[model samples]
Target: MDSAVLSGRSLSRHFSVKGAAAPVEAVRDVTLEVAPGALTALVGPDGAGKTTLLRMAAGLLAPSGGSLSVLGVDVAARPQEVQDRISYMPQRFGLYEDLSVQENMDLYADLHGVPADVRRERFERLLHMTDLARFTSRPAGKLSGGMKQKLGLACTLVRLPELLLLDEPTVGVDPLSRRELWEIVRQLVEQERLSVIVSTSYMDEAERCQQVFVMHQGRLLAAGAPADLRSRAEGLSFTAVPRTGNSARTLQARLLDARDVVVDAVPEGGHVRFIRRPDASDGAVAQLLDGLPVNPVPARLEDGFMMLLRAAPPPPTLPTLPTSPTLPASPALTPPAASKPARAAGPAGGADSMIEVRDLVRKFGDFTAVASTSFSVARGEIFGLLGPNGAGKTTTFRMLCGLLPASSGFLQVAGVNLRHARAQARAKVGYVSQKFALYGNLTVRENLDFFGGAYGLYGQRLEQRTSQVLEEFQLGGQEHMPSGQLPGGFKQRLAMATGLLHEPEVLFLDEPTSGADPLARREFWRRITTLSEQGVTVVVTTHFMEEAEYCDRIVIQDAGKVLAIGTPREVRKQADDAGNMEDAFIRIVEQNRNGGAP
Candidate 1:
């Protein structure tokens, strides 16, 4: 048998909630093994015990039962021995915010007891691999989300180890950066024969691993190669596009409610896909999608996951409340026509010239966050800013929103110079930040009221708008729940609802669906399409290439410069690989990195 770099026998972990009297089972009876030179993925939704399992493997947490061994070292009895041979990076790895990139590397190297000469070579290779040599003197906190993730990975790789544990390494990273990180991992596995176990929510990333383990409510649901699991979903899926409005949410809700007929449903672009139980027949599926349009299609890893979770028997006892609430139901709003685009009022023409940036530049002393770059966004259009992490997308976004002053270049919004009428321009735009910008302590309704009032909404008008948003987002029943208590999907809905409360002409969303499930992402875009029907213009940034399909046009950037700009189809055509945006993005960014024209 292949050597087991890490092995666990019925491992489990229990934690006590601060206010709850009982200790919650974060991980339960998980039996698994990590083989040498293999990439194993631990996947589940948030709070599904992925982190708990990884921590236990790293000897950072003591399992309540079962046995764990790291390269023959018993984790519960000889944690120090296990730690000495493993490199573990938690979700929030200790990347010193105030320290320069090189300084932070040096600190970690010292802590790991790496020799000076060896550390020099390792650090040099890491810097080159992560493409951080150019920003060696930049502070860690100043780095973009993707850059920080890369730096964190680099620091952990400062020393060679038998096992590497990465806890949700690419959770908030952009697609380009995520690809780079995966490339590095692949290279390490080949060159060092490294055994790696990474926890992630992205099925695409998980599919690339040598093996996958699906966890739910702290128990192992399934484990195998991606293809193996996908094969298990055979003859269980079908696709259906909406005839009017956002049909995905309605389809998802309908299928979910029919527990006996359909096991799981996921919404892909333009369609809602489902997976039926093994015992389900074609007629049963037809009965489930009875009133909707449907077509048979192939099953994917996501479909398998949904089916497995849906079919798993519920635990004897109820699981503890998750860190967040479940995603909201889909809205029933109609999507606007795709042909007639809304134009923002501007000097160029009608709403088509809603925003104009001439030689836009933003610099911080000797460093430039955004070099001289220019672009425009039309009203009623979904405009996407695509780039690697720390590639100036946020800087450009900040400048357009008047949140940061540009060192040079002219920026006009709604036919007025942003510099001269910052507040007026802002008033016409809705902005959802990359971070959770809502009040966690306040209920969803309260947060909406606060934002509405800030936008000058009052009394009857505010009440009417709030009710409309609540209904549209399917949050009518949970308006009283604290925003902090909502799940990742619901929180996203609340954020979008708040942004649209003022009914601004242009909406700016920064990575709006980052860290959300595929179903949640599909539903989020559905609402955006609904708003577009009402003539709301949208400018957003995202790490998911699939999400780009929803956009009317996209702008690609790298290192503070524009690389490509066009419709999704047009931009994709520039790729040598044909239709794969992920491949296309990597090719474009890599070419630019090597000083080649996109």
Candidate 2:
């Protein structure tokens, strides 16, 4: 490993907490070598020390034990020199919202000592590569989520460093923007021979890297090529289709609950893709499938991840909650009432439509954020809104929720027009925001109590409901933990619990599982499917294309209008059978942007 660009021998870091009996080992006995000009990945769930490891490599955090050498330099003793040669982008990058895009880029360029000529040339190429050329004059604050991310990348690259480290770069980004960002990174790697180390929760992203390091609880669980990991799940991977009447999610839940036989279960293309535990009895396996046809499916990086996790020790606690009090809908999220209504509802959303939008338009000055979008969500449906970053999905969601006013169009929820009975209409729904908006200092129990009280739950009744939801989400044991200290999966469970406290007829989840791991994602969808079966209509917006498969119908929008809308299968067909949702989504958006098929 002498030729390795970055090498660590028994690398470890520890943090001391005031009340903890033992100092927390953020990184422990880790040994690895990263080759030059190669793309490598560190994959793990939140709180697994991925961030800590990245910080140590970038010379921002000193290791308590073991040795780390970067670019053949001792990082611990010469952190400043190491810092000058590597670019580190944390989960949250620093970008001035008040500054124009060009100004931000210029600031970074000046800081990095990029000369005038080099700055001009680099900015041109960087902006072009990031598809941000046209947006240079706009204020960074006004840019879409995806655009802001690209701009951040450009700022980092104003002057290249010897190594690039990105921490969960696409956490909350939409599917299309995610692919685009990767395209830029891939291009940089090929053209400049730059080396990159990225820590990600996405399995697909890991597959794209030359090597991956599987980490958990601050220890190196495994390391190898993607193919080697995939081989671990061979012979056990499968796709199980439901009987004529059963939905994929329902079947998936059944398998997941059968812990003795099922290893991992997810709904894909209206089918349950799962893996069986190697030691399960034949009868246990047969009973779990319930006579369904089991087709052998190729193992994936995600499958391998779950398999590896199953072999490891369980986390210190059961971190998932079955239910929690529903979080409050964001103020100003629901759009104002619709002046004109009465659109004929079809079988999908017509007269029976739980959520409806017709000829909807929202404008900001001369720019229309959402243009003439029309759709209907039938009762008990999981309706997904999909689009690239900066698309009008948020605009449409705001309008439907009555947080914003529609420029013009009819918007209805639960047969109630938002234009007029806003409060009444809002009363029928719950909302979970993309960001955790809870009071950090408060315990989970306190947050739940506060939210329940806001929903007018009080006295014994409020206590009863709060207690019930805590139990449901399996968070009763963690109720006293600080809300801010919860892991990614636990925080989401609490957020959703807060939203469901009142048991609203409709629930809105905006990127609910955006930064969650695969296990956390499966649990979220299981609850959603359960709610659908209980006759609650769910409207969700997510960047994870695979999550869309759990939806009964999905709407794809771009710029400011609906590009495609239908079942996942129908949308895929519309995109000329792109093979999968991500491909279909990209194909459809590209085609529509180019004035064609999509």
RMSD to the true structure for each prediction, in A, is 5.8, 5.8
Among all windows of 10 consecutive residues in model 2, the one with the lowest summed lDDT is 331-340
Off by over 4 Å in 1: 1-3, 9-25, 62-81, 117-121, 124-147, 234-300, 306-349, 366-368, 371-374, 408-410, 414-417, 440-450, 457-487, 593-598
Error of 1 at 368 (Å): 4.6
Tens digit of per-residue lDDT, candidate 1, span 299-371: 7888787767666665333222344234444445543222334432222224467788879888888888788
Per-prediction TM-score: 0.79, 0.91
TM-score of 1: 0.79
**For model 1, what is the C-alpha lDDT against the true structure?**
0.78
Give me the runs in candidate 2 sitting further than 4 Å from their true place.
16-23, 318-347, 350-352
Go through the candidates in order and give each one's C-alpha lDDT.
0.78, 0.83
Model 2 lDDT, residue 565, Cα: 93
TM-score of candidate 2 to 2 decimals: 0.91
Angstrom error at residue 203, model 2: 0.7
The per-candidate count of clashes, in order, stands at 5, 31
In candidate 2, position 3 carries an lDDT of 72
